[model samples]
Target: MLLTIIYIIAITAEAMTGALSAGRRSMDWFGVILIACVTALGGGSVRDVLLGHYPLGWVKHPEYLVLTCCAALFTILIANWMRHLRSIFLLLDALGLIGFTIIGCQIAIQMGHGFVVSAVAGIMTGVSGGILRDILCNDVPLVFRRELYASISFVSVICYWLCIHFGLTLEWTVVTTLVFGFSLRVIAIYFGLEMPKFIYQDDDEQSASSKDI
Candidate 1:
């Protein structure tokens, strides 16, 4: 029940963000709705497809699809007021990231997967929606550049696994992981903490070799 509530909130937040992105690009209402739906549900769809989990979440629960579309339209209605709620939006996005991560990790664990697969599932669920949103908006994917986003998702997965391994109650594990992950993300944003980028400037030799090709 807790997870289901969080999932709804997460998708709503994600859809709103996606709608905002489309608005920034001057997209029409149809584009906004399309981006919103993809951003809200693309990650889980991808995960289910990869894992061969039959019936994607939105497919099984058409209400979720309706909710996302509603959220998208609502965002468009309040677009003028959104700038004042930037901080709130960021916090909601953080919460969504952790919620998505915990939900994904739990699903994988229930499927009898081990640590690594669960970790990947969690990270994918947490970040891939935003990636699709950015792609649709023609912006670089925030997951690849945002401060501690995907890493925090992975850490949340590890935290969830450790809690379960130590025999924590499922409810407590979910709560703890959500608190820890959300706090970490908030701190990262506050401090502008980021993973070091790997810049590969083409040296003269490499440039020449590429030119020859």
Candidate 2:
């Protein structure tokens, strides 16, 4: 039941993000709903399949689909009233990412998975949906580009693992991790915090060549 609620919230966040992006692209209502559902469900589907979680979470709980569809539709209807969909989208996406990361780690731990495995699973759960969404939308996934992205997931999972190791209750551990992760991402966005650029192996050569010209 709790997972179901989490999935609904995840879908709502993705729906808002998609609707906002779609509006910027001038996509119609159908496009918005489709993108939202795909963005929200894609990662969870992959995770379940990879973990051999039978029936998949969405298939086992059909109301999740209903929730996704409704949430996507409702967000689209109200999107026009918002003056700055971009900001809202960023906030919602960060929140959903945080919740997904925490829940994924907790679920793995509940199933007796090790900390390393749970951390990786949590990062995957947080980023994979957005990756798939961007791929389908023909844009680069934000995870691979600048911004805190997957690092936020990594930090969050680590915090959760620490709390768990310290004898903290599962609920509080998750709560703290979610708050930490969400706050970090929000701050990163607000302050334009991002990953450092990777200088390619031949960046020096390229720079030298350009300078010579």
Candidate 3:
């Protein structure tokens, strides 16, 4: 029940962010719903499909689909207010990412998967939606550059694994992972911390490469 509530919150926040992306692209209502659903559910769907998890999430619980659509429409109604609240959205996005990762980890563990598979499931749960969103919006995927996003997800999964391995209760595991993951992500955002980038450059002006990305 707690996990289900968290999942609802995660999808709602994600759909809001996705709607903002759609608004930036000046999409119609249909486009807004499409992007919102993709951003909110795409990751979990990808993970489920890869793991051969039957029935799928949205198929079993169509209410999630309705929630995303409603959240998208709500975002559209408050578009201007949203622009002024970037930091709030950032925090929400961080929460959503961590929440999704935790859920993904739980699902994999329930399915009798091992640590590595759970970690991959966690990462996919975190970033698959963003990848689809970026591609649809015609922007380079955020996970591919300029941020510690995907790495944060992987690190969170590691933290969750450690907590479980150390014999922590499920509640403690969830709280620990959520706090650890959220802190890392917000700190990364605030300090502009990121992974080292490898720029592919020609021999000519090879040293002209910059690190702005």
Candidate 4:
């Protein structure tokens, strides 16, 4: 239904952005498609597996895989222009994050899971695609260090739950989650907001010995 269409748009946007990442590495056509697929669908696949939700979507509807590959190929043709449209891509990426978060929460809710599991599902769906893409591209996972991306997803789940708790309709919950989550994500990206980094010291053993003395 409406959710399915939004999911399509989300994956299309994600695949295109992921193709740009492949372009950065100067990967071959196959590499481009692989990265795009990982970025667009890996999160949902992981979420389903973790929740024991079988017959994964892309598996059930192989056309979704075809869509991502085609989107990546199309992006290759427009790679140069994408550089000038980085902001647009950022917006789309943020939208994808919110869309994924909402869908994940919905799926978990349908399964009658509690709020904690629902929250985990939302975060996993928001975060895993980028993590897979980064690992494949040999980049640090952006979710682990970038702007409040995963945190926003977590927050979105809580907000969605609250909306349902207050007896809001599906339409209201969807709109509110999209607006609130997308706004928070885009603002965090614009402001370069980040959680504190935990820097590891190479002098750990030395510090421990000093403490013993």
Expressed as tens digits, the lDDT of each residue in 144-184 for candidate 4 is 98789889999999999999999999999999999999999
Instruction: Give stretches of model 4 more than 4 Å off.
Output: 204-213
Give lDDT tens digits, candidate 2, residues 1-213.
544465567777886676556667777888877777777776777776777767876798777667777877887677667666667667777878878888677667777889888887788788887787787677877688868889999999889889988999877886788789889999898888988888655476597676665
Q: Tens digit of lDDT per residue, candidate 3, span 68-177?
A: 99999999898879878989888988999899999999999999999999999999998999999999999998788967999999999999999999999999999999
Worst 10 residues of 1 by lDDT: 204-213
TM-score quality measure for candidate 3: 0.92
TM-score per model over all chains = 0.96, 0.84, 0.92, 0.92
Weakest 10 consecutive residues, lDDT, candidate 2? 1-10
Q: What is the number of residue pairs that collide in model 2? A: 0
> What global local distance difference test value does model 4 have?
0.91
Give the winner by TM-score. 1
Candidate 1 lDDT over residue span 1-213, tens digit each? 988888988999999999999998999999999999999999898788888888899999999999999999999999999999999989989999999999888788889999999899888888999898898888889789869999999999989988989999999999999999999999999999999999876787689677665
Assess the local accuracy of residue 90 in candidate 4 as a C-alpha lDDT between 0 and 100: 87
Global lDDT of each candidate = 0.91, 0.77, 0.92, 0.91
* lDDT score for residue 182 of model 2: 84
What is the C-alpha local distance difference test score of candidate 2? 0.77
